[model samples]
Target: MGEIWMIGATGRAGRNISAELQADRHRIVLVGRNGQRLAEAAAAIAALGGPPPRTLVTDDPLAQIATGRPDVVVNTVGPFGATTVPTAHACVAAGSHYVDLANEFQPVQSLLGLDPAARTAGSTLVTGAGFGTLATEALVSELCAGRPSPIRVRVAAMPVVDGLGPAVLASVVDAAATGGLVYRDGRLTRSRLGAHLQHTPLPDGTMRATVAVPTGELEAALNASGAGDVIATSSEVPTGRIARVALPIVGAVLRVEAVRRTVIRLIDRWQLTPPATPGEVSWAYASTEWEGGETRQAWLQAGEGYAFTSRVAAMVATRLADGDARPGAFTPGALFGADLARSAGATITLDSNAKDLR
Candidate 1:
């Protein structure tokens, strides 16, 4: 059991992470912008078992975190693109391991650049511990587990659930609007978003989403700590048609500096979407294919994406606490076996269209 200073403890992923960590006998220090809300999270964590770590509410919680010097710091306070650098530095300075659930690629890359500094400080700094990179990366890596050459890897992730926060949505738009980054013909290249749409079979029938570019983290993992030429794509489809209609508009707001910053400020002002409602449930379906002469593929279903990510992150943190993890910037796919992703409870299946090997 380790002590965790959870920075966004009252948020959706934070609450879920707190639950997962508590189940493992780790202590949780719930920190949020609200004292009442943090206290509530603390109470719920306490009920889960071994006395909860202290709950502290402060805008600059790192000062408080430095004082406690907990074993781990889970920064569920995203957007990672905005907060990872500072939080990672603080964790290193405090001699605590750092984990986050950010969906953006830029910030994750930033964290990777800090590897040497973190090691010098004797702390492990991990990014993409959550859905944006880890789960999807893990799913894709597992699809081609033991294969070698002449392999073609393709991924299509479609998100269907409550809307992503503007920052997250922007990350998708930024990658999409920028163009597609595909590992085609054994090399990485760029194309446009919405240009790679495919009709995939879903329980409700054929569902559609564009095969967008791969995240830097995903590219690194699929390439095996940056080795193979694996093509990857990620996309978002509205859970409801209304959200679909609003996506372009939201994407627009993100493109403009004033609107983008305003939206971020709004997130900070509200402290959360839906004004203190932490009930965030997200879902996604990922279909992947790996082919040498024959093809093997799988459809991965995560009923509630963020909820599952929180669990994955907690599990990673657990491994780190016990010195069971490698120190550096990483994704679960880069570390775990196929069973690692499966044991966490995602629905996995062999692609039906897979042709006969013989």
Candidate 2:
């Protein structure tokens, strides 16, 4: 097996992915800024039934990826808006495949924009290799298959997370600062943050009040379905009646650049904990309405968020390492199809019986 280097190897998601990749018998090189934490993570991986992964402590990740020349580099670092481009470029330069667990809008779009370069360099770059984007994207792909371009596509991500770290909080704040966006008439347009609230029904016989968020799925859905209108939402936002009333007001404040930065810093410094533990199952839902009045919906159910994310990241990296992926920048679904999501433990269900194509 070729050596795979994982950045942010000590992070929660990074450690889990490391163990999974190790279980597949892949040689892992743990890369992180802290030596002690990396050692501990390596030990944990070793305990999981693999030889201790080689560890590299480095502040300059790009330089290390270039010099070490691993077959694949998995980036688990957050605030990927800042990390994705540089790291992906380094991978291209080193002729190494790159994958990141990024679901943020800017990073996902930014990474995809590098497709020409990645193809030229003969390296595959994949973003949103996590539950946040993959599940929804896969559903969109499934629904739109063999159908005319959809006029509208709506997607929602409802994940059950056991915990949230300060970094996750910071990422949310950063997304809020990006405000809301959706694809309309085949072009991206801005919308108010937390706008367009809806009670999204899950396949598990329940509904969650979701609000529009500028998630990477918005772009992925548009690409997958060729939809002229797209709205990406999430159940992560506050959904109560009172909370819904106040969200727009809060979003207004967050839209201010300085205020957003201050909020992120405060959240980071205080290390705020999320209020509740999410449920055991996570879901991704999407509905598409086509030009001929045909409508279709699909659902993806998976285990808890972080564990699912680990599975997805490992699966994508494994595929790339084994030469299953072609040279291009892609999301997991766009590259490997919805089956990859299923292989990583997501149950997919499509609803087309009620829709008439004729």
Candidate 3:
């Protein structure tokens, strides 16, 4: 088995992905900032009745990637706007394949923009290997596969997570700071945060209020569908009338660097988070409209968000370690198709009006 280095090995996503890889008898090296925590995680992995994982404690992840030069690096670190670029650059420089569960718009775009360099180095870089972008992106691809280029594409991600971590919160805050972003005329454009509020009907006959948010799904959907207009919304965003009214004000404050930092600091110190009772099912929907009157829609149903994320990340990492991936940057959906999510316990349902592209 190829050697794989897992950054943030002790974190939630890292722990789950490591367990998945280890269960398959893959050789893994747990890398984290805390030596004790990394050791503890390794112990837990060993206790799971597989090969014990090696440990590396380091604050400088780039340095570790450069020197240690593992065959593959799975970066589970977050607020990826700050970590993704440098880490990816290091992986390219070191000629190591890289994969990350990053769903932020900036980092996803940044990593995908590294195609030339990654190709030159013969290293594959996959981003948005998590529930954030993959689910919606997969749906977009499924809906647009047999059809011509769509004029408009709308995608929504509504994951039911069992819990939230500080990193996830930070990522949300960072996206909020970015305000509303949508692809228009094949270009990224700005709008108010929580703008384009609408009621999204889930597969279970339940309607959830969703709002426009800056997410990697926006970019992924555009690339996958080649749509001229695309909007990415999420059920995780606040959608009440009050929230809609206050979003502009909040978005303005977050745009200020100092204010954004203070808010993030407060969130961390206060441990402010939403409740933890996640539902058993997560839903992602995509609707595509061509120039005439034709339209298509699809629903991607998956298991628990975190569990599906772990499986998706594991599957992608396994493919990378086994040299099944091509040298370039990609979203899981763009690289592996919607079936990747199904293999990770997801189901795709198409509207009666839409053709079953699968």
Q: Which residue pairs overlap in candidate 3's backbone?
A: none
lDDT of 3 at 313: 93
Scored by Cα lDDT, where does model 3 land? 0.87
lDDT of 3 by residue, 53-107 (tens): 9999888989989998888999887778878888889999999999898887888
Runs of candidate 2 with Cα error greater than 4 angstroms are 255-262, 265-269, 353-358
Give the best candidate by TM-score.
3
Model 2: per-residue Cα lDDT over 73-148, one tens digit each:
9998767876889999999999999999888798899999999999999999999999989989999999988867
Off by over 4 Å in 1: 65-67, 149-151, 159-190, 201-208, 213-217, 225-231, 238-253, 268-294, 351-358
**TM-score to native of every candidate shown:** 0.78, 0.94, 0.96
Candidate 2: how many backbone clashes? 0
- Give lDDT per model, in order: 0.62, 0.86, 0.87
Better candidate number, 2 or 3, judged by TM-score: 3
Q: So what's the TM-score on candidate 1?
A: 0.78
